[model samples]
Target: MGMEYQLFYWPSIQGRGEFVRLALEEAGVAYLDVARTKGGMENMLAALKADAHPSLAPPFLKAGDETIGQTANILLFLGARHGLAPRRAQGRLWAHQLQLTIADLVSEVHDTHHPVGIALYYEDQKKEAKRRAEEFIASRVPKFFGYFERMLTRPEHRGVYLLGARLSYVDLSMFQMIEGLRYAFPNAMARLEPGYPGLHKLHAHVAARANIARYLASPRRIPFNEEGIFRHYPELDEPAA
Candidate 1:
């Protein structure tokens, strides 16, 4: 805890980095958003290459001398250190399992905007993106949201958070998911959100947390933009049937 955690990621756009940021903020952990600092981009680039176990991409964490990569892996590590995850093996694994599922959903969301390839501009893949987004909005949205809704409404875990009564990183990620999807697909969400009352309630619960509220109000919380996973492309979003 003495060593200040250093987060290495892109200077702009919340992207996947925001998930980690939200966990840290909610846990009241002090971390240096390295890329936002002077010469920080260079530092991030260097860390990506120089580390013993180089990460495939950004959004990795450096705690003390250990470098943790991947969003879920990093979260798994931080979740244990902080009280952001469950104490027991079964509960912790359950939290991580939900996190992995969320990761899959996030990947799908990214592909909707960049269906053809990440290297290609959205303009180059507009037709494909439209098709993908249409299917996602029609099918995937309900599939994922319904699963989470049911999870929250389970018999045993009858709480506002995902892992039941406690506030886990899963809840934080769900809040981000709703926030991102709402930005990316406002029309669709406006029509669809009413069905998922538990998610709405959970979103409100996380948003009102003292630390998270402060973070949201501060400049540290980057605004959603075209560059992030959640983009407000008018054609890609529509109200549900």
Candidate 2:
């Protein structure tokens, strides 16, 4: 029988939840996508408010009596349980390091539109978003992508994935990042793609994974839109190359 893992996240936006979802799907693990289910968001909220421990922002996991929060932490827990994480001490730490880096990039992506404050709306903060988006497109995106590209191209682990041979949760998160960035900044990504062949290849390879392909085709995966973290505003994108 498959393990029972319950995921709690916001229903509307993919955001950080996509990272956990991707890992679950790729691992072929049967799990409950709680918030996406009927009345799931309400249940998630109740669970959060009731907990004595410090609750996470979103995308948490529950296994039996235990509840854990944060995207990277959830992924780490699942990775070790499902044998997706490396057994070696160094490899395990590296996987976590990669995951944390992805988390940082995800936050930067969110901040591009809501840099001033999360309490404010995009329409209310359009001016700040434009300025933040400029910095994001010009510097942040390239810096993060360049780092991952270099990691993948490292001589010690020079194959397809960050860990050379294995397909870890980090690989899935990178694919999601690439997808989100392409949607959020199409023009910038088009020009930037040429410089990060490793990332491009990684994106392509992950897309071809059977489970990922199925998840992409299925209604379970929400399409990118204005409401999500990675939103596509033509103004935010750079000029087409």
Q: Per-residue alpha-carbon lDDT of model 2 for 1-241, expressed as tens digits?
A: 2558888888877888899999899988888888888888888889888865547577788888888898899888888888778988788899999999988999899998888999998888888899999999889988998899899888776569878777889999999999999999988988889999998998899999999999999988989988888999888777887
The Cα RMSD in angstroms, rounded to one decimal, for candidate 2 relative to the true structure is 1.6
* lDDT computed for candidate 1: 0.93
How do the residues 1-241 of candidate 1 rate in per-residue lDDT, one tens digit apiece? Answer: 3637999888789999999999999989889999999999999999888998789999999988899999999999989999999999999999999999999999999999999999999999999999999999899989999999999888887679998889999999999999999999999999989999999999999999999999999999999999999998989998445
**TM-score, structure 1 vs. true:** 0.97
Q: What are the runs in model 1 whose C-alpha is more than 4 Å off?
A: 1-3, 239-241
Query: How many residue pairs collide in each prediction?
Result: 0, 0
Clash-forming residue pairs, model 1 = none
Off by over 4 Å in 2: 1-3, 52-54
Give candidate 1's total backbone clashes. Answer: 0
User: What is the TM-score of each predicted model, taking all chains together?
Assistant: 0.97, 0.95
Question: Among all windows of ten consecutive residues in candidate 2, which has the lowest summed lDDT?
Answer: 51-60
